[model samples]
Target: MTTLAEEVLAGSRLALARLLTLIENEDPQGEAALDRLFPHSGRAHWIGVTGSPGAGKSSLVNRLAQAFRRPADGSPPRTVAIVAVDPSSPFTGGALLGDRVRMRDLSGDPGVFIRSMASRGALGGLARTTPAVVQALDSAGFDIILIETVGAGQSEVEIARLAHTVLVVEAPGMGDDIQAIKAGILEIADILVLNKADLPGAENALRTLRAMLELGRPPHEETAESLPVVWRPPLVPTIATQNEGIAELLGHIQAHAAYLRQSGGWQVRDRSRLQTQLEELLQTALLKRWRSSLPEGQYQQILTDLQARRISPYQALHSLLGEPPLPQSIQRGSTALFNA
Candidate 1:
């Protein structure tokens, strides 16, 4: 029997879905399949779409996917994959919104695949398994993967590290222009999209965004040869509900992709993302291995002392690591008196 990874490589959508589920559940089988599939990954362009709540991000993403499937410049259409992340239900940890409902128009397309995921309390907008899911999609031969983040303002900059190009969507009349000035998320945007452009105050919103971009850029130097290639983020106004401005937006996205390739930003982003994933996996593995090696109930005993205030948190951590506790005067922020 062909392995699931082999099936996915042969364009089996059902196998792909099953593998995604296994990966999300942290199944060992999924890890093995992913390892088998990793050699085929990294070919797709990862695009991150993020912004404030109710900014029409879903609509924009929907239109962008269509554009990818039918390029306006008469270029061959590319396969598209979408990973839409929704907020998790606080009680059940289930996705609150089914993004597939909003993207029903693309459901019949053979070249497009959409996956909805729950944030599951993972911070910074994406689900915990999103990058792994993206890798699966990439290995399956998708040309572009759009990752739509949960609309969490400010704390949503994680996508900057994952995607080759990042689109920060903002809507007019939503006070997003003001929030753009205050939010660190704007710094990570490769393109600033003013979605809902047909709404009132659109021009004002556009002007505000342009001004902010100007302020963020470094001043021009007289020596032109000394400067490096810089991509100034363009502001594209779109009425996504009507599919207006989508072609132009796609043009900008394509341009950004070309720039990344020319400037080596593509490889840089890939390296950084893989490094982060490696470090996180290493940390988790080390913690689990260490915890399993400890004497039964010793970890719990440390926690008990920690909660009772009999030992400071630092002391508890040192004890768990089999390290000698530092002197109270030497420990940073050490105020508790240790009784042990």
Candidate 2:
């Protein structure tokens, strides 16, 4: 069999899906594949779509894909990858796998690569290995990548750290939902998409958003002689299921991309994302090593002792590794345990 990396580089869809599965499972080979592919990444534009579960994020992403499918010239269409994250069953630990069902029409399209990932207990709305999967898609030459989160409340904020642009989707008659969104998602959104805008309360929602925009001051102030400018984010209304406003959404995305480039925020965002990813990788590796090196049954004993209050967590941790607590003087000179 061709190695997963070779097949992925050669644009084999099966290999791409299989590789994504391995990475999601955190297989050893997946780590090796990421190591091989990292140098080849950094080309694609990553867009993240997230909101409450009923906001139609998948439908919006599907429409966005349709809008971007055709290249400007008569040349072949640019490849696009969609990573749709779904909630896994608590009992079975398997995804409900509904994203693929929603996106069935685009599954067979050679120009679009769609993969549904199970959250698999990742604390944030994203999958634990989502960044790795995105890297694989990026290195595989996908021109654009869309990541859809599990729609799990505020934790979806993490998507902003990974995506170049984040679309926060909302719908009609969701005032409380919109308030909840403001707590976290609002800060991350590059664009706010009010989907299902044909509904009765859509206008009210739009007005609410506009009022919210007016409350916040712009990041920068204009000189006295200059025009008083508002840095209001683009709020676009869309009926995604009907394919209305998708073209405009694409235009907004392109415009934002241009803005990022011109404002120098693109490189800064990219660097910050890469740095966060590096730290996450280090954390994963350290946890794996720590888990593997622990003596059998030691963790269970620690837990039992913790519950009984016979041992404090700090003392138990030090005891498990046969280390004494360092003196304050020594601690100042030495690196922290996390660094160690």
Root-mean-square deviation of Cα positions for candidate 2 versus the true structure, in angstroms: 6.0
Candidate 2 residue lDDT tens string, 26-127: 899988887888888998999999988798999998888877786343565667899998988888887787877677668668899888888888866888
Q: Estimate each model's TM-score.
A: 0.93, 0.85
lDDT of 1 by residue, 1-340 (tens): 8999999999999999999999989999999999999999989999999999999999899999999888878899999999999999889877766788789889889999998898999999998888899999999999999999999988798898789999999888767665768878889999999999988999999999899999988654433444337778889999999999999999889989987787777898899999988887899899999889999999899888999999989779889888997865765444344532
For model 1, the superposed segments whose C-alpha errors exceed 4 Å read 176-178, 219-228, 328-340
Q: lDDT per model, in order? A: 0.90, 0.82
Task: Note the clash tally of each candidate.
Answer: 0, 0
User: In model 2, which regions exceed 4 Å deviation?
Assistant: 71-76, 177-182, 217-232, 294-297, 314-340
Name the 10 consecutive residues with the lowest summed lDDT in model 1: 219-228
